[model samples]
Target: MTHRFVFPTLALALLLAGCTSLPAIDPAALPATPAAFKETDPRWTAIAPAEAQPRGEWWKAFADARLAELVERAGRDNASVQVAAARLAQARALLRDAQASQSPQIGLNAGALRQAEPGAGGRGATLVSAGAALSYEVDLFGRLSRASEAASLDARSREALLQSTRLLVQADVAQTYLALRAIDTERAIVGDTVEAYRNTLRLTERRVQAGDIAELDAARARSDLASTEAEAFALERQRAQLEHALAVLVGEPASGFSVAVAADTPPLPQVPAGVPSTVLARRPDVAAAMSQLQAARARVGVAQAAWFPNLSLTATGGVASPEVSDLFKWSARTWGIGALMSLPLLDGGRREAGVQSARADFDAALASYREQVLVAFKDVEDELAALRLLEDQSQAQARAVDSAARATALSASRYRNGLVSQLELLDAQRSELRNRRQAVQVKAAQQQATVGLIRALGGGWS
Candidate 1:
């Protein structure tokens, strides 16, 4: 008995000694990061990235009640977000399945067999057997543990992706709603311009009837009025389309959903004055990529473990008897215990191929993680640059709108007193309308850029 135990214990010691540690990527080898962002504003303060934390209702900072409501609805009902949530759940379940492999398995079975007794000259006998079996595979090489770790990381990646989806949906809804509101304000401006053109046409017609102006002046005035009306109609068409798009974003049918026309657009949300360059790490997409890279690294360990032998311990106990009534008797009791060790000597290079495949997957994941980090930095820079440039452009456009409005007023007074031609008056009116429309568009762009920056910063700076 002592010799039997000694051999098994010696074999177990050898297997334990051969266990390998999982491979890990060296942090020093990863892509270098900047200490500060090029576009960092003076008002920004340095803070660490906290992408794993909950991002509350960031849209409320805009102070737009309708926009806040719409964002909430999209978070709850958006199809993409729902799909991501389902995938996260699946990944978690897979992690549990992988973990189950590390635990012993138990099974109970019962059966009745009818056969002839070999030495009894074809005498028939009935045998009843019941048994309980337990088996456990020792994780001597860490294969099962690495597999579980990979599955856990996969679940983490899915969870981050779900957060990314929710943020995307919220930002999209806010931008679309704001765009629709800008269109409403623009339409109102065009409507006012159309009325002004009509009044100009009426004045020109009166002068022509009195022989104070040429008939060509009256025709020119009429043409200007018609052109302004066409512009107003075009704005109406654009507004309709924007409204339809907003309806779909809020998870409503285009035919059944509508937003009330409002001349007021949502105010731009304020950006934190001092944002740290490390904020890029808070991006959900980047986090997902990092998780995927870790998972791939763990799978490499699992593949490398395939070259080691697997040891399983099994035990069974039960009773068997030819008579059903005697199956459970102590005299008929039977039991067995065994151990198995499988080591494949030749497999046509299948294990090597598995290791190579796992290594390649790790390389791909590493590259993807690096790319995601770069993209996060790029997104923040793009929106920051857009906001800065658009602010200057909007201010310049505002000055142009004011000057054009004054010019239109002066030209109209001069045309009435015969100091200016109808052509000059029409030119001034067109300039005013164009500048006003451009101002509205610039304002919309600024608001959209604010939304983009918020999204790029992982939903909100806080």
Candidate 2:
């Protein structure tokens, strides 16, 4: 009896000794990050990245009541966000299923059978049966544990991806709506210029009738008015297109949805840029990448476990009788118990291939995780650069608009006093309109860049 237990005990010890745990993944293994941003404005304060935390109501910082309302609506109604939520739910369910495998399974079964008895001259007899069965895998090699860990990690990955999707949709809504407002502002400018040109045409026509101005002056005024009106129409068309895009983003049909023409761009928010490496912790996409890498590592452990042994226990208890009423009799009681141990002694290299494949998958996940971190840094840098350069452009454009406005006023006065030709006055008017439009466009760009920076910083500064 002692010898009989000795062999199994020695085998168990060998199996335990041979088992391998998953490799540890370190965030520090990724490429080193820069301490400070290369292109940052003096207005932005840089602090070391803090512990990762949830983002706040960052959009509300812009102080636009309408934009705040629209962002809330988009978060609640966006189709892409709904899809991501569904996927996250599915991953959670799958993780639960993996966890259930760790527990013993019990089932009840019932059956009736008719068969000929060999010793009873081929007489047919009906037998009735009922039973309770139990089964459980003894996870001796950690296969089930690793599988459950991988599933749990996968669920976490999905959760992070859902966060990423929500951030993307909200940012897109902000940028699109801001662009529409900029178009409205431009349309208003053109409409005002068109009215001024129309009045100039009427004045020129009256002067021509009184023999005080040439007919060519009236023709030039009419031409300018018509051109300005055309520009206003084009701006209106662009506004319509942007409104349609906003409708789709909010999960509504464009035909049934509308946003009133917004004439004012919201003041840009002053979002500070945190330490450059902090993006790895701040961005949900980066978190998802790391989660996937961890899951892949768990899968590698599961694949390695396949080379070891598996143990299982099963039991059944039942009663059978020719008559249904006798099924529960004391004399009809039956029971059984069993233990099974299986170890793969030989295979056509299938297990080895599985192990190799799992390792390769892990390697791929690691590389992808590294790439995601790099891309996150690039996103922040791109937005920072855009905001910085656009600010400089906006300041210069303001000066240009001021100069153009002064020139247009002086030219108009000169034309009325017969100091300049109609062509020269019209040219001044066109220059003023162009400069003002450019200024508004630059302001709109600065606003768009601010939103982009907020998004690139993972929706908020820490």
Candidate 3:
């Protein structure tokens, strides 16, 4: 308001900007990182260069066109993915709002007010004013700068979270579809066994009529056929439930969607497990956590900046006249310029509390980031172990299935030739069916684990 005060204000502003500073954020502040995974056995190796990005289409590795189509549809139509996308858009808007504070704000203003003159004979006069005003807050203490930085990092975190959500949805669809196919394979096996047992039962009845075998033998054959038929029906029910779940995942009504019964299990792809650090970095969840940590650190700087004085520069240029007709005349013009300095002399403990809260948030984000890193490595290792052991289990189950089939054939011949009892033949047949079903189940597990490994590695081999 006065020239005498202007020089002192300018000198004080220079001193505050020079003396005030916030703590810098360093990535090294985090806990120590692991160089490699704990279970990097000889069987597993680093991913290839081509696998690093790989277009992020891991489902294509199974070579299932239908699966690729379904995944693509889910990305486009799933409600959860859409919600995440909307959140990203909102974050971007908030970042823009924070950044806007750095720019000069210009606005138009117009108003009319009637006032009664005091100590007068109740006389009133109308005053009309109209103008454009400009204002800007000079970020001498870096408060606005830090706030903008925090908003920018928050938007990045939202983007990474969106990617994580999409990866989760895609993986879920693949595993559910694989499960449906596996049930189909088991159902086909049961269907064939039931038909074969029916033929055997008819032959047993003919032998009983000729007095070659007792009635008990015919009854045993009949019982085996009925049990196998019941299992096939159970498989059908399971398939219906899985199909319904799959439809919901794709954001479709269950009554309108169906997967045709497939007699073959889908192919299992070999997902590579890279070094632990590299794999963790590629994961979207880890990236999101790291971004949130950086955002928190920026907020801490913002809170510290709040303790320092704030400086702002403002300007106004407009017209003012009592009569509307003279509003635009040069004689009615008015303009002013100002510098405002705001300092919180005393506010109890609000500023200190804010600084502490910001620091606490930063610590929480840092912990979350470290936990995500640990979990990422664990997921990759778990899937790797499952795939390795399931491989061995599948091979052993295949051998059992083959042996069971051979035993059932020999026992059937022995019974027809009066060399073995009907009960022994039934035992061999049931054992063969059980072994076959177990083998199929093992293969299904291997397929599902393969998908899990791919997702853990962040979409592709790497």
Candidate 4:
């Protein structure tokens, strides 16, 4: 009767081991790419190559040595990039650990003890035993395989995320540098305007004393001078703030770092355009999201494998005797091997709940991946439209600045020759200032938009 029961139990274990269920998944079942790109302008319709560039040196296109150096430093020292890199290393270590589990684990056992008898004639003996034991779980249902797959995908995802963080840091440094340059330009303009206004105020006061102009003109000149001074103060404040921000972005104390402005404006780099669909593969975030989705899908397989039986084989061998010399004798040899199996006959629906939970997580991952793709497309389109409009506006602003300069020159000549009132000269002066300020603003906008385009294109970083 005992043999019959043993045979039935073995048969049940074998039957349960073959009961694993894995769902089928096809990569082709993923959603189609959305039609989000619009027709490009004829002048800007040419697409650039989408080949990856050297890692973390993408700012060389600007031809600014200082900017390049700053980017290099930030990439190496930035806290956020360091954190991402650490996470990537951790994920790789975890993958190694998971892969190691596929093989058998062996360990050594050794111990020695001494005890004295309770009688007056005390005696002690040293006990020394050494052996190696091994335990290995049979992955008959591919549970270990699926788990390793998930771990590898997670490692790849972390690597992609690190790349994404590096790109962001590089872009930020470049944008902040451009902003600092723009503020410096504005400061110069404001300084010259203030000087001109002060001269105008002094001349107006002289003309009033000479009875050539009314006191009202002097008051207006003073007001204009005051306004220009106020603008200069504001620009100074802005420059200081930008300086502080740039210092922090580069991982330095704000007070210890300062940026020197070049006399020439920084030229915008040429951005290569690509198809919207290509961005899905090039953007690090998008790639990371897809990897995460793959990992979650693999986890579904892992969860399903849990519903079947688990098989483990263990073996232990050692020599034991009351005397140390007798331990190696033939009579002291002892060894045993056994196979263990566990099947979930009834769990009050816990195994089913695990399957459902895994499915829900898989569904959420898919949704997140889709959303990332959509947002990536949207970002590219928005940058495209912005670049187009800003280019046109910049040209128009250049023409307006020219026209205002000519008008200012003519009005000043008329005032010197007594052909026009000082009020007319003042109006032209105000108009010229407004036009120049607007021109500076337009230039800044163009540079900023170009930077945005580079970022949207993943900034030539891989």
TM-score of each: 0.88, 0.87, 0.86, 0.86
How many residue pairs collide in each prediction? 6, 0, 0, 0
Number of the top-ranking candidate, with lDDT as the measure: 1
Q: Candidate 4 clashing pairs?
A: none
Greater lDDT among 2 and 4 belongs to 2
Ranking by TM-score: 1, 2, 3, 4
Model 2, position 453: C-alpha lDDT score: 77
Query: What is candidate 2's TM-score against the reference?
Result: 0.87
Question: Local error of candidate 4 at 126, Å?
Answer: 8.2
- Candidate 1 error regions (>4 Å): 1-29, 42-49, 205-227, 276-278, 406-430
Worst 10-residue stretch by lDDT in candidate 4?
A: 42-51
TM-score, cand. 3:
0.86
Q: On residues 1-462, what C-alpha lDDT tens digit does candidate 1 reach at each position? A: 966965676586467546655567766656676666677754432344456876677898889988888888888887788899999999999999999999999999898999998999999889899999999999987889999999999999999999899999999998888898998989888887787677778777888898998999889878878887898888788878888877777788989988899997777776767654445556789889989999999999899888877889999999999888898899989899998877676999998899899999998998898788778878888998999899899889999999999999999899999998875786788689889988999999999999899899887766
- lDDT per residue for candidate 4 within 1-462, as digits (tens), equals 966865676676557656654544444555455444563523332132232333345578778888888888898888899999999999999999888878998887866667675684888656656677899998877889899999999998998889889888888888888877877877777777887788788888999999997999899889989988998898878878888887877789988988886545677765554434343345778778888888998888888877767779999888766678877888877777988877767999987898899888888888888787668667767877887888788889888889988998999899999999776786677678777878788778777776676676666522
Task: Pick out the ten consecutive residues of candidate 1 with the lowest summed lDDT.
Answer: 41-50
TM-score of 1: 0.88
Question: Which residue segments of model 2 deviate by more than 4 Å?
Answer: 1-29, 41-52, 196-228, 272-280, 409-426
List lDDT for all candidates, in order. 0.84, 0.82, 0.82, 0.77
lDDT of 4: 0.77
lDDT of model 4 at position 235: 81
Poorest lDDT segment (10 consecutive residues) of candidate 3: 45-54
